[model samples]
Target chain A: MTARRFLSDLSLTVCGLAVLVFLLLPVLVVAPMSFSDAKSLEFPPPGFSLRWYQSLFGSDIWVEAGINSLVLATISSTIALVCGTLAAYVLTRGAFRGRRLLEANFMAPMIVPAIITAVAHYIAFARLGILGTFHGLVLGHTILAVPYVVLIMQAAIRGFDIRIEQVAATLGASRLTILARVVLPNLWPSAAAAWIFAFVLSFDEVVVTLFISGAHLTIPKRMFAELIIQVNPTITAVATLLIAFNLLALAVLLLVSRRGRLFERGY
Target chain B: MTLPGSYESGPVASQTVAAAHDVAAEATAVPARRRASLRQWELFFLLLPMLLLIVLIFDLPILNAAYWSISDPKTGALTLGHFRDFLDSTAYLRIIWRTFFLSLEVTAATILLGYPLAYWATKLPPRWRIVVLGLVVTTFWVSILVRTYAWIVILGSAGLINRLLMWAGVVSRPIEFLYNEFGILVGMTNVLLPFLVLPLFAAMMRVDMRLLQVAETLGASRFRIFWQVFFPLTLPTLAASAILVFILSLGFYITPAVLGGGRVPLVANMMDLLINRFARWETAAVVSVVLMVVTLSLYAVYQWLREKNA
Candidate 1:
């Protein structure tokens, strides 16, 4: 029995290590390929060079697309955060008829297949004369992203004790004052989390963007177009940079929410 | 001194008058407090923008898609020809089968590997557990495009694995790893594994460690304790994660498109081809409708079973 148990444990460890390597190998491969000296995608590099990184920086299309992605993500995420927080506040604090229905509506976007949503948006926006515009893209992405913000904020609000707000109101504070001073401070971690999540959702979004984006090009859309037209190492450089940026964002989020125990709660 | 009938009548009328006055006062006070509570209507008013945006953007678009699926483009009349075309074709049927099987394979792989990792995580110290889980969830936040691209770089001809194998004399020739079903499976599994792990970890954490200790004291072997006590409790989470992964995998397009290199076709890829290549919007809409119905039915079944058990 002891020998069998030992063998099983050993096997489990081996399996775990193999899985980890599988997860990490692709990421590991890209980091070096981004620095390859050759113009073409060849492994065991003929030599080492940073020409791809230089090309990535020098290209006007790449620069414009990067700026476009950042602006769209930032504006859309902020809009989502504000709208979602308001909806979350209403859901948590206000008593109204059909509250359950409203909550379900907020959640529907997240649960429904995103492809269906993308297709629908494509058809609707095309007819409305807004297709391919930055405004259309931002509006579409905000709708896609707001549900995440609402979800996180709802969880955050559940942990809050309402009695504190009641006490502030009883102590002669106005409703707006209490919200601004007491509620907002306590809700910061969730709000920050929601904002970050919204930003990432917008940044990473491709399917919906593919449908609505006409002349406007975001980073993902540009990369996709390039992939179909030609194979280039610039994409590897861009991907490496994105990975770094995501890691940075994750680190910052962890630092801010460490004390709040936000990661412990599941969405 | 007074007459008995007159004195009794006066006292009875006075009591009745006082009771009527008290009832009117209570009714007036109730509405006043209700009016005061109505002051909080601002919250709902604040929620209006979000509601309107969702209605216009999300609700209307989906309804349009459904309508378009039924509307015939050529005849300008409502018809079911697109649906019939999709259902009748052997090519489409095969594509659907391949998509379903690949998604199932990926889901199974994710669960088989993710479950043990989650279980092991529960045995670690709390701080280490958080860090490890953080790493897993962080992977979830990485863009799917980036991850898929990374896989391409690793699996391409003369890529990392091939190069390493050749250097180590493991094989004489580079293997055809990319642009195949095997590549899609590998990439999709990596992309979906984090989704499985998070939910499973949550489920595993709910199983009380003390219960396992009790089993140990009762002379059950460690393996038996795990199977009889731990595994049964985590079954619901396992089921939930499997459904989530499977459904998400069904709609997956990027990894398959990049790695499959046009050999393997999924429902999403079919939709793309119909719309872009064939300019057949009606056919694309039909395919989308089918995908939606399949996903929703599976979801409904899962929910019904869960509710019945509850």
Candidate 2:
């Protein structure tokens, strides 16, 4: 490379690294600060302690909220996975009129702002008298999460070949039998990724949860409430833990998807 | 389940009418023999649970919100007065405007900062490229709540920057970095950066470096080649991420609330105020309708642009 080109490349690399530093800044501060012995927000702690983690795990509200989030995410994402995968299968495999329109309608929830959905739930759940109920949250989150499931499965189905199912049909296998024995096995990896995607999306959701859920707290709602209610160090500790949890999840996903080569084409 | 003629009656009776109507109408044009193979009924059964979930959970409830926006409390009659009330309020109008501009600013910032980083990753060796891209993708899995909390720990008055500044004797007192417009932007941009980068990185991978080589051979300066060739190639992804980030940022409630210290009232916060605090469902619904229209229309534009470009 020429001197001028080398100089320009050096400057670009420096600037890029600076941006990466900026990206890493939050995680750096939050993780270490969680280990601080200070009762409040302090940096470069005079001493270290596990008080915040103890607080996070020891508190009933935090534990309950965590459990609430897990249960809701589990139920909703499972519903979304089954419903959305079926929808995608039909959209991709079945010859039908207005298929494009159906696909668009299915994809709509992903783009629609969450607040609108939240307000919608606020009204519907109130009327159903399921407001603050776990089932109500499951209903709302399932709606929010289905679009992701459908979109992911749609991509997966488009890449898939239907010859196996056709061959199975020619062999006198029933449609249900073919679907169970052929199509689903072919789609399992995508299905797994989509399930995890839906689960994580629903887990991270807050705006709609705030509206539909009252008294019952999810992790995000609790964290949001805590941040607004008081700037607590425990929240930082909680955030650190959540970050660690998410990183672990991402690693697991990367491992699974790499083995399956699921995201080789572009997410 | 037996024949194409038996298409209408199902659990997802809502969309079934529309699909069955289409099928029947098309069936008349075709011969009875081909119609026997019609799978619209099977399709209907396949799509039933999903259709029902969407209708009952998402579609109906939103329609209800829209209904509550106009229904009069006394006689339960629909009216346009609620919309007028929303339009008449200058405070609400300003909040909406501020929300738009804040989102615009954040989106612009993300693009400006993220483009270079994404482009740089493309220039890196394959080994380094994976590392950088891995960092960017991993950031996505982190929840917004956790990221925002991280921002608080960093930006707090007694936090990292302030303490460092004080220790360096840069100032007598700590800067009030948290609970301001500046903090809100920093926190939002941090959380939103990964979104902008991943898309751009994906787009950048498709960029043909041979074109740049061709430009280099054709006597184009490096700056000229990048500005005239490389930049334009990536513009579509830039546009896509920009619109996406802006729309997502517009609906943001947590980061701005915690960082803005309730000082900056975005539309979502205002929506919260109207519905939760003041119990003004009509006004909140009107705001939601407005938000939905704007968000969806922009998304429509995004889809159209992608298709047009495609």
Candidate 3:
């Protein structure tokens, strides 16, 4: 490369690396703090220990909340996946009236603020006498997550060939049979992507969970409550574990979908 | 007209024609059955879950919030006292202005920082592009609470930046980075950077490389080509990201609460304080309504701009 081009490239690399560091620094800061031996939050701590993590694991409240979060996320993601995938199929494949309106309604949750949704759900569930229940939180989260699933599944379905299904219909196969055998097989990657996206949305959800989940405490809510009371490192330990889980999940997803061209397919 | 063939034919022939008509009717009815069944199943299985959710959670709650906002507590009379209080109080109005300006500032900062990073990412090879994009999005996976705490550490009085500055003899004392507007801005920008970057990157990636090359072939300078061609195409993405970041920033609670240390109160914080601390659900409801209005207006503005540009 010419000197000018080389200099420009070097500058770009430096800037890119700087941005990366800026993004990573906050996350990296918590790792050391989580391991701090001191009671208060101290950087470059006097010593390192696993006391905070141990404490987090030993606490019943923390354990229960963690379990609650996992179960809620699992159930909600499943609901979102099923509903979103079906809607995606109908919207993408079927030539139906009001399809645009249905599609827009499905995605409305995403554009609305989570807090508003939460408050709305809180009031509605209260009137229905389901407020503060796990079922309520699950229902709310499923709604929040459906938009993501629909978006991902819609993208996946767009790449599918309608002619394949048509061919199946011509060859003595029922439409249901074609959908079961041909369409869903090709939809696996999108389904998996939707599931993962839903999982993350539920797992990280806080604003809505705060209002709707009256007595129930999901992990994020627990962490927020703890933060308000004190600057606890146990929360940090939870965050550290959550961050690790995210990375591991992302890694596994990347591995499994290696041949799927996920980003190119618009999930 | 049909009587000639019927009368000439045997009883068996007539029976065969009847059976053929029956078979044809069955074939026609079968497809109708299948179509109806599929439609019924789609409505029940595919659409019902989301529809029920929207009705019970989304539709009802919004209506209730509006109702709660208007209902009067004293004498069980309907009144607009909550909104009156919100509009009447200087403190509340100031809080509203503060929240608006803070969101605007954070959005501005994110655009300024994120655009260059996104532009740079587009220049890299595809593999590297994915890696960079992943890195940017991975930040999203990290909880906002943790990100805020990280900022506190970095911007705290005896924190990383201050300590480094002090050690480097750049300052004599630790600066007040926390519990102020600057601290909130720093934290908010850090959290919102990815929102700006992703959309901007999406737009920048769509720019035709050949266009820039052609400009270069025609003896246009790199800066001139970028200014005249590339920048104009990226404006819509910039506007979209700005709207997104601003709306997200408007609903922000945790970051400002932690970093501002109660000095900077956004609308979300006001809602919390009113509901939790003051036992003023009416007031909280009013604030929530106002916030919804603000967010919706911003979204409307974005749509309008997009339509006009189109």
Candidate 4:
């Protein structure tokens, strides 16, 4: 390559990596800052400390929100798993009229902007007198999570072997027995993906929840309130830990997929 | 109508159906009996929860919003007075315009910085490409709240950028960065850049490198080849990400509210304020409807453009 071309390539690579750094800067900054001793968002911290980490672990409000998010995510993911997986099965396995329209309806909530969802949900929940209730949170998060679960489940179900179920049927297995024994096992990876997706979505969701949420606060809703009201290092520690959680989850997902493929080869 | 996956089920299902029909011709035929009973039973059992969920959780709220917006005491008698009030109000109109322009600006920034990065990353070898993509995905997966907080640290009066600038003697006083339009732009662009980069990189990687090599063989300048050959092919990707980012920015609540420091009121934040502070639920609902209309119209236009080109 000519000198000019080499120079151009070098510059482009520099710019690209700089942008990559820009993308990663938030997590990188928060990760280290969580270890910092400063009360404020200070740079090149005077010293490292774990006081903020201890604060998060020690505080009742933070602990309660964390538990709330866990419970909410679990309930939401379970509902979404059942609903999305069943819909996926029907769409992929059952031959029916208006399936396209049915599928689109499942996806509509994903497209409708969150703020609008907040308003709509607020009105309905208010009328029902369930605003700020546990069931309301479950139902709301489930609606948000179902479409993602549906997308993943549909892809999984499309790759499924219907012949396995037919063969089981020939061996005198009932439909439910065939599903429980054959279909569910193959679709476990998809179910796992669905659960994680729903869980994370429920955990991260803030905007709509901020609107319709009652007195009971999830972690993100609490974080949103805390950020607006106070600038504290404890939240940074929480964020750093959340990043670690996501990494762990991603690693688990990789293992799940690898195991799934190995199981497919074996079966 | 025939089911979608029926033919793809191959002969196993067809043979079973034939066998079921051949056995007793009617009363005990497995396919017919199962079809009439199992299909309905299964459909009722399986599809009902999801169907009810979509209705109760998704549709009912939306219908409620629309209903209340029309029937509320302020806008009652089924009139468009609330919309007219919004249309008539100069402040509300400006908020809507500012939202559109801000979304446009952020989308443009992401594309401008994202294009070169996406292009170069696509040219990288596998190892480097994975590293680059790993960074981008981690950023994308991380919560927006965390990122917004980091910006507060970086843009604060005593934050990193100002501290460095002051230390360099460039400015004796710290420049205001957080809680302003500039901060909002920076925070939002930081968050949304990966949205543009990921999709654009995927599109860029699939481009025919041979086409560029052929153009090079034809003695076309590198710049000419990029502009005339490469960039045009990625226009659809560019347009698609631009609209997607813009629509997302339109509904942006957290970033602007946090970064704008209570000054820069985007429509979403304004709507929140109207509902929460002012108790103008009907007005807020109308604004949401307007945003939905605008976003859907843009999406429809995009769909039309895709179809027209096809």
Candidate 5:
């Protein structure tokens, strides 16, 4: 019985370790391949070089796409933050009928599949004659980003003490003033986390952007297009940078939320 | 008490009754009633901009798609031609069926792999548990496209796996692992694994350790204790995440497009082709509505399971 138990435990550990490797395989493989000297997708590289990184930097299209991705993510995430934060505050604090229904409406963009959103946006934007416009792209990305912001901010607001708002109101502050001052200032850490979440979401969005973005290029969109056509070593460099960027964002979020214990308070 | 000759008392008696009513209102629910209305208005104004944006951008487009699916695009006449086109075509049905089965396969794969990993994590020391789960989340944060792209390197003809196999003489030639159903399955299972693992791990942690201890003390074998107690407790979460993975897989665009190399066009890729490649807006709208309905229905079930577990 003892020997049998030992065997089972060993096998379970081995299986668990194997699955972890599988989960991390892409990240493990892609980062090293970016530094490979050989042109092909060779593992245990014959030699190490930074050629792919150099090529990625040298390419004008890549540089342009990077700028576009940054701008698009920044603008959309900011818009989502503003609109979603106010909506979240209302949804959490307001005594109103149909609040649940309205909250669902805000979250619908997230629950509905992205491909459906892509097709819907494609047809609607085409009919409105804004299919290829940057404004249309922003709108599409913002809709996707809004739900995350709403989710995060709603949780944060719910975690906040309502008595504080009542105290501010008792001090003769207007509703908007209390929200702008007492409420939002205390919720900045979560708001920042939500913004970063939305930013990463927009930065990585592909399906909707593919459908509606006529001439505009973002990193994921470009990488997707290139991937479907061919594999390039330069893509590994871009992928590595994206991995680093996302990890950095995640680290900042963890640090910010840890200091605030934003998640621990039910977020 | 009733006022005497109130009907005939004219303005004097009426003023007295009004004053009584005002005093009663002030003594009772009037302040709260007024505050509730005021708060509602504030909330309304706060919620308005987001409502308008969602209605105009998100809801309107979806409603527009539904309209397009059922109406004549050029003349705006109500017709069933688009949906009929979808229903009558075997090609569309074939792709839909293929998407269903592939999503099922991916869901099953994730559950099989994820269940063990989550279970194992539950048995680990706290520090190591965090390390293992952290790796899973870090992978989750990586781009789906980047992860999908990585598979081509690992599974391509001259890729890592093939090279390793050739070196060991495991096979005489490279097995074709790209641009097919097998490749799609592998890429998708890898991409969606974290979704299942994270939630399952949390649920596993929530399973009571005392129940296992009790079973063990009662002379339940290790296998019996786990199978009867621990696994059953975590089943709801496992089932919930499996549905989520299924729902996500049904609409997968990137994996099938890049890894499948257009050979196995899932519903998403098919929609992409209908709209972008062929400019068949009405047909794409029909496909969208169908996929949306299927996904939402499954999501409702997923939510129910989650609520049940909670």
Candidate 6:
């Protein structure tokens, strides 16, 4: 009996650890392979070099895409942050009809599949004559970003002490003034975390951008186009950079929302 | 049709009446209630900008797509021709069936691999639990495209697995792993494992330890204790995460596009072809509406299961 128990426990341990390795294999393989000297994708690199990084930097297309991605993510996430935060505040505090319905409407973008959104946007933007325009791209990304911002800010607002806002109201502070001075300042950490989340989401977005981004190219779109044509080592460099950027953003988010448990669902 | 339409509008008509009655009462109510109504208006003003943005950008696009799906392109007359075309064509149906089955396979694979990991994490010491979970979360943060791209490097002809296999003399030649269903499954399972594990781990942690102890003390074997006591407790969350994974896999575009190399076309890829390649906007709209309805229906079930777990 003891031996059977030991065998079962050992099997569970081995399987669990193997799954963990499998989960991390992509990160493990890509980061190391980025530095490979081999022309081909060779594992356990023959030698370390920055040729791929050099190529990635040397390419105008890649650099342009990177800039486009940065600017788009910045603009879209900022718009989403402003709009989503205010909507979340009203949704949380208001004693109004259709609040739940409105909240669901805001979150519908996130819940719906990206492909459907891509298709919908492709059709709609074609009609609006903004199919390839940068503003259209920003609007597409902002829609995607809004849900995360709303989710994060809603949790933050709910966690905040309503009594403090009430006290301010009782002490003759206007609602807007109370919000600016008392609430927004305290919710800054969570707001920052939500912004970072939206930024990462927009930066990493591919499907919607692929459909709607006519002339403009973002990093993922470029990587995808290159990947479809052939295997390029420079893509390894881009992937590595993206992984690093995402991890840094995640670290900052964790630091900011440590006390909030804002990520209870883990997206 | 009329029965269903009237049944739907029945409550809506009564709801309008009820709302008007409430408004009349509120207008006649005391000063504090009047002040509360004013605050509601203030909240509405605060909410208006975002609402306008959402309606213009998000809602309008989807509604427009639905309109396109049912309306004639030139004449602007309502029709079911696109949906009829969708049903008449076997290619679209084949792709839809393929997507459903592939998503099911991915969900099953995630549950098989993820459940044990979550259970094992619950058995670990506190410090080790954090380490394990952090690794999962880190993988979650990594871009899905990057993760999907790594599979090509790891599974391609001259890639890591093939190279190791050749070096070990396990095979005389490299295996065809990329641009196929096998590659899609592996990449998708890898990408989606965290979605299952994180929530399942949290759910496992929330399971009552005392009940398991009581079962053990009551002469229950470890196997029976786990299967009878622990597994049942975690089942709702397990079921919920499984549904969530399935829902995500159904909509997966990146992994299949990158890893499948266009060989295995899922619903999303099919939609892409319909819109971009085939120039069939109305058909794409039809496909999108179908996918949306299916996704939302499953999501309703997933939310129900999650609430049950809570």
Q: Which stretches of candidate 6 lie over 4 Å from their true place?
A: A259-267, B1-31
Judged by DockQ cut-offs, the docking class of candidate 3 is acceptable
Model 3 residue A199 CA deviation (Å) reads: 1.4
DockQ agreement of candidate 2 with the native complex: 0.39
Q: List the residue pairs that clash in candidate 2.
A: none
Error of 4 at B309 (Å): 9.1
Worst 10 residues of 4 chain B by lDDT: B1-10
| Highest-scoring model, DockQ | 4
Worst 10 residues of 4 chain A by lDDT: A258-267
Model 2 chain A poorest 10 in a row by lDDT: A256-265
Interface RMSD of each: 18.0, 10.2, 15.3, 7.3, 14.9, 11.4
TM-score of each: 0.89, 0.91, 0.87, 0.90, 0.93, 0.93
Stretches off by above 4 angstroms in model 2 are A259-264, B1-38
Q: Could you give me the TM-score of model 1 versus the true structure?
A: 0.89
For candidate 3 chain A, which ten residues in a row score worst on lDDT?
A: A258-267
In candidate 5, what are the lDDT values of residues B1-310, reduced to their tens digit? 0000100223643454455554444444435677667777887888888988899899999999999999998999999988888899999999999999999999999999999998898889977877887777778889999999999989999888999999999998999999999999999999999889888888888888999999999999998998999899999999999999999999999999999998998999999999988999999999988988898899989989999889
Point out the higher-scoring one by lDDT: 2 or 4.
2
Model 5: lDDT equals: 0.87
- lDDT digits (tens) for residues A75-163 of candidate 5: 99999999999999989888667888898889999889899999999999998999999999999999999998998888778877665
Clash pairs (backbone) in predicted model 5 = none
Candidate 1 structure quality by residue, lDDT tens digits, B1-310: 0000100113543454455554544444454565457546666577898999899999888888888889877676888877888889999999999999999999999988888777767766788887777667667767788888887777777677887888899999988998889999989999988777876787788788999999999999988998999999888868877887898889888888888887888988887787667867777778788888888887766566445434
All candidates: DockQ: 0.26, 0.39, 0.30, 0.42, 0.38, 0.40
Isolated chain B TM-score per model: 0.84, 0.86, 0.84, 0.86, 0.88, 0.89
Q: Estimate, for each residue in A178-245, the C-alpha lDDT of model 6 and write its tens digit.
A: 77897788788788888999999999999999999999999999999999998889999999999999
TM-score of chain A of 5: 0.96
- What local lDDT does model 3 show for residue A149? 82
> Model 3 off-target regions past 4 Å?
A1-12, A168-178, A263-267, B1-45, B71-81, B301-310
Question: Chain A TM-score per candidate?
Answer: 0.93, 0.94, 0.92, 0.92, 0.96, 0.96
Q: How much is the lDDT of residue B240 in candidate 1?
A: 72
What are the runs in model 5 whose C-alpha is more than 4 Å off?
A: A259-267, B1-31
Model 4 lDDT tens row, A1-267: 598899989999898878777777777878888888988888766699999999999999999999998999899899999998888888777777898888878987877788888878887888799888888888898999899888777777776655555555555666667667777876686578668867878888888788777898888898888888878889988888788877676556546554323111210
